[model samples]
Target: MPDQAERLRELVRHWELRRKQTRRTIAVASGKGGVGKTNLTVNLALALKEEGRSVTLLDADLGLANVDVVLGIPTTYTLAHVTRQEKNWQK
Candidate 1:
């Protein structure tokens, strides 16, 4: 049986092949707080980027956008702005 790293590599390879046809989304969530969801999401995005894939990490938490805090990126706009059509989501 393949190890954890090997399984992840295989999954990445599968995604890489499908990436040319369409985009993908991965969500990290937990019903409880302080469960390291943000940490895992950030690290997973970074790892995917390191593997030569384009990744966009979107934090949908309207109240506390913790992903921005974890990444040390000050967000001037969020999904709310995008929903209102005031900001482009791709930007």
Candidate 2:
């Protein structure tokens, strides 16, 4: 591998170590639509994935969900369909 590739791998390894050592949950919110909120969520999830962290994107819009649309995951089930304990947002 080239020098830059080795450096990137080293950084990824470092991030993986950090991810393993610390687990944190963060909620991203926005008050306006078409304001890049979904984009931010998508990018954040991608970043965490790059860092080897487990990330789940939840639409939480009850009957409507667009995260799957932004991320392009077909909705198999919605919050409306999920019962009390059927699926606790474990995407």
Give Cα-based local distance difference scores for all models. 0.86, 0.76
Clashes found in each candidate (C-alpha, N, C closer than 3 A): 0, 0
lDDT of 2 by residue, 1-91 (tens): 4799899999999998886988677787666667777778889999989977777766665644588888777777777656656765654
Cα distance off (Å), candidate 1, residue 28: 1.3
- lDDT for model 1, on a 0 to 1 scale? 0.86
Question: Which TM-score value belongs to model 2?
Answer: 0.63
lDDT of 1 by residue, 1-91 (tens): 7899999999999997787668788988888888888889999999999988889989887777788888888878888999899999876
TM of each candidate vs. truth: 0.72, 0.63
RMSD from true fold, candidate 1: 7.9
Q: What is the model-wide C-alpha lDDT for candidate 2?
A: 0.76
Question: Clashing residue pairs, candidate 1?
Answer: none
